[model samples]
Target: MENLKHKARKPLALSTIFLRYFMLLCGGMLLWLGLLIGTYLIATATGEILPANYVEKQIAAAKDILVSSPEIRPDQIPSLSDYALYTQEGQYVSGSLNREQAQKAWKAVASGSKGGIRGYYTVIQREQQQEVLLLSYSIVMNYRSEWLRTHLPNPELLGIILIVTGLLLQIALWSYLFGKKLAKKMKGLQSVIGKIQNQDLEFTVQSSGVHEIDTVLDSLDTMKNELKASLRQQWEEQQARREQISALAHDIKTPLTIIRGNAELLSETAQDEIQRDYNRYILTSSAQIERYARELIEISKTQEGLKLERVTIDTASLLEDIEELLRAAAVEKEIQVHMNAHNMPDFIAIDKDLFQRAILNVVMNAVEHTPIQGNITLTAEGKSDSVCFTVDDSGGGFTFADLREATKQFYMGDRSRSSGNHHGMGLYITQSIMLRHGGQLVLGNDEVLGGAKVTLEFPLS
Candidate 1:
């Protein structure tokens, strides 16, 4: 008990399963933040330097060309297409420049300003004259390139991509690792419960490393083993009882035959009328006893389950035979027996003897319950996937208990409803035979006949 208590308390210990997962989540967030910050910093630095470096390179190249030669003349200077040279009097010189552009460049240079029109510029004294030089470059390239560079996956956008990618990758990795650690055990439990719901207990339950789960699985395994053993023991006992019944029935048959034969002989040899009646009673009782013995033997065989020997038979012929066989009994009782087939198949596959016996049992049960001058109807009809055999008797209908337990073995109703000769296995044996043929027996009160209604339904193969 102490050990069990300790086991139960194990899960409540200061365990780190949740803590570990929480830490993994925190680490993933940290990684996403780190990647985002790093990407943003790098992209921002590059964004700043790229356009500045491009403009600086262009300015440096132009400066190198102008200052590298010592004897260069203003008229013979190389063309600076991007720059507009201007005199201190606002006149354009040594470069391609429109009048307005030249005036704008000269104004900035002559006013001793540092900036130029449309772009940056510088003013310098000429090498041999007091005339100042105005140098300007177009602002279009620098502004357009800088806008494109900053906007085509800019720093903010790159940072967002990096963070999203990092988070997604981390989530995938964490989910895979977590599932590997626990999902397998949960899946095993799910499979076991699913099979149990289906009433399948054949598979083995393995232990999960978790104490609580392993305990539950162990308990389930133990329960399954106990149930299996119990069922086996019950099956063995039922088989042994069937064997004893079969042996007893076999042992009684010879003596019953002798008694029947002796009674028959005595009926012929008897002189007085009373002696003949006594002999007749002996023969009748002997026949009933023999029938009981036969039924007992059949019960034993039926309990062992049925092996069918199938034959093709038609519904019309089958019904006709039943009517003809029971015609004498009905005539003796002054009862009306009717057998009919409607929309029944011409041919059906069934174990002819067993099927006939099952039908006869139900019909005879009705016949016994019915009063003289009453009506008994046996019906056969074919359905979509099966055929139905029904018997109705114009007698007292079944009670609720009869409807519930009529087909159970050795079940008898009240003395008023039950026959003294009945051993109560007729409907039970009939139902068992019907089940063997993949069919069923249904019992209900027949309103039309004012009696019991028994239906035997057979599957069409």
Candidate 2:
């Protein structure tokens, strides 16, 4: 019984079951109506089959009583068989018995005042061969109450059973549907999560058409995209750092080897001049070591967020100082050093130390790359909005693509111009400094000089 209750509660298709029950209710009402009509018709036909003589005698006696008195009232009638009537003016008038009233009177006559099954009858009266005769018949009301009481189940019990069954069916159907849909959505989420757990970032979950579930999946997708981007950026940074370290090691190795060879030569030599030359070589090697260490420390500082301390510095004095420092190196390479500044402002806001370092690095790069007798021009052009500095070196020009990625940390062009220690951070730091000062660093092949050109644009005060 419990299982049956569960089944009823969980009917397979709700729409189909409701339609069936509705049809059953309509058919039951139609059948009940048909039974009522049939019972009424049968009762009427049975009344017609009753003896006519009985109805006639009762009707004649009622008519005679009504006629004998000029005034006849319903209450003063002599017999149950007599009929009475009242006029419209409230006077007593004579009347014959009607079908309905005679039916009640005949029940009293036949059952001695105990009504005959509480129904209607008819009476027919006639005077034949000087003898009065009556014919009476009755039509008992159809006892539908008795039929229902005997055959039908208790109405309250039946109603409760139907209600319980319907509720159980609906609950079962909804539960199954909910469980199935939930499982489907959960499975999809599980698959996506499993792929993510396995480090498969490319997997995407299909939307299940459920709003809440789809919203969660969309959020997961967004998180995955962000994670992928972060990982990719980290990987690129790691690769750049690795290349920088390798270049650093290579640059230090050559100087260390030279220093070691010079030390050994100094130990083996006895001549004063040879000893002196060895000492100079040792001094040069030591200076190179110190330079490398300083460069490494500067790079570390830059990486750790070096901030510029602004000060008013004379642009002309700054240019003069840089030219004096680089003149001997340019002379050795037979490179012409030209410092051209026309209409230059006297003072500009700058970090005197870091800005000098950044600019010197770019000048040194130009000097190292230019050939003998190459012209290296450093020009500063002052505009209303900004100050532009251009360093054009007469050397082999770079490709279009190489200019774009030249400022990237540790990025070197495919064509090697110098065998010297080049970590490729000089231009990168120059670009960084320019950006920090609300300016930009641009690089291209010089249109006229046919060499590399670097331009730094700084905002005016």
Candidate 3:
């Protein structure tokens, strides 16, 4: 609150900048207006307009022209707008003015009116003759040649145009200057935001030359630094934990192998049936523990992504191994396991251990869901550019929820199909393996078996 109060007490510099620009605009226009008026005054003072005696002076000068040419043609008269010779009866002889304009001028001369046909006029007389000389001229200020006078606009209208055009130009100039300043500051902010959006947080945030935008940039920079540190720390911890679990699982394998070997030897030397049963129990339990340890190590590897070691193996041999392992898994349930290994590639490239494990996972899942005496079919064949292995079990088919989410990690299906022992990692592991081998896992209900059908497709090339 103290900082806020101190900052608030300071006057806004942005407002000062705006006020300065506004004042400059007003002063500039005033200066331009004054310049126009001053230039016009200087020109006008230098005999731009004739004095009041100009009409009387022109009349006195025209007496000689009237004596020399009684009938003055328009072209014969010099230094006048128009000229005409008229009798005492007001008849036009020759002049630049039309008959109507001449009559209007004649009326003004006869009645001594103050106004005539839109210009100044004067008349000259010779006392011995009945002829009269009438001359007409515009009373406006003169400048430029006759062509320019006829073509150019009047001074007042031209001044108004210049002032309006200058005002518009000033408005555009000031707007560009103000917008360019604001855009410069905004561009700095946009650059920082763009870097953050592109996931590139390694940059130095600079001032935007504005208090408000700089405030935002400060906060954003703080957030970026904090987020980067948090991500680095999180990644380090996760990596350490995974490494520890993998090493622990690997360490357990050796002792577990020793325990299972001792149990197997004791079972072979059993003298009583009860002792044999106890030996069998120890062997079975140890085997389960060993399998769990192996899966734990593999799962840790899979959690990131799996890497495959492809080796050339006979397709028939691979299928026979899968069939034997799957049959052993379903022995307790008394399920009939059948294998169809026809029309397959003789030798195919595959990761032997990983591929067998993926096949085992799918079949083990089927065994768990299938009832006793149920039949499980295994099909192996090549189609197009891929080798496909499909497992179908004679049991209840997969529900819609299972179809959609069975392969997702930790997604245990409905209790009716999953039972109590199933942990929902079988299909997930199989899918990860398939993906590593550039393949895909497909799930559906088999029409013939009337149970879940799982197909694993591995690319041949």
Model 2's alpha-carbon lDDT is 0.62
Q: What 10-residue stretch in candidate 3 is worst by lDDT?
A: 1-10
The superposed Cα distance between candidate 3 and the true structure at residue 297, in angstroms, equals: 5.1
Best prediction by lDDT: 3
28-83: candidate 2 lDDT, tens digit per residue: 55555566557446745665222224434444556665445444455433222344
List clashing residue pairs in candidate 3.
Answer: none
Candidate 2 is scored at a TM of 0.45
Candidate 1 at 114: error in angstroms?
Answer: 23
The lDDT per prediction is 0.69, 0.62, 0.77
Instruction: Estimate TM-scores for all models.
Output: 0.59, 0.45, 0.62
The digit string of per-residue lDDT tens for model 3 on 1-461 reads 11121233433356666787788889889988999889778866775433335445655775586666645555545453576667878887657778888888898999987565647776766444576777787555445346645676656666789999989998888878988987886886798789888979888776655667667777788878888999899889877767776898898889988998898777777369757755665676577667667767886778745667899998778876787678777878999989887678889999887888788789888998899999999999888799899999998979999999999966888885667765566898799899999999999999998999999998898
| Model 1 residue 23 lDDT score | 87
Residue range with the least summed lDDT across 10 consecutive positions in model 1: 1-10
Candidate 2 segments exceeding 4 Å error? 1-303
Decreasing TM-score order of the candidates: 3, 1, 2
Scored against the true structure, residue 332 in model 1 reaches a CA lDDT of 54
Pairs clashing in candidate 1? Answer: none
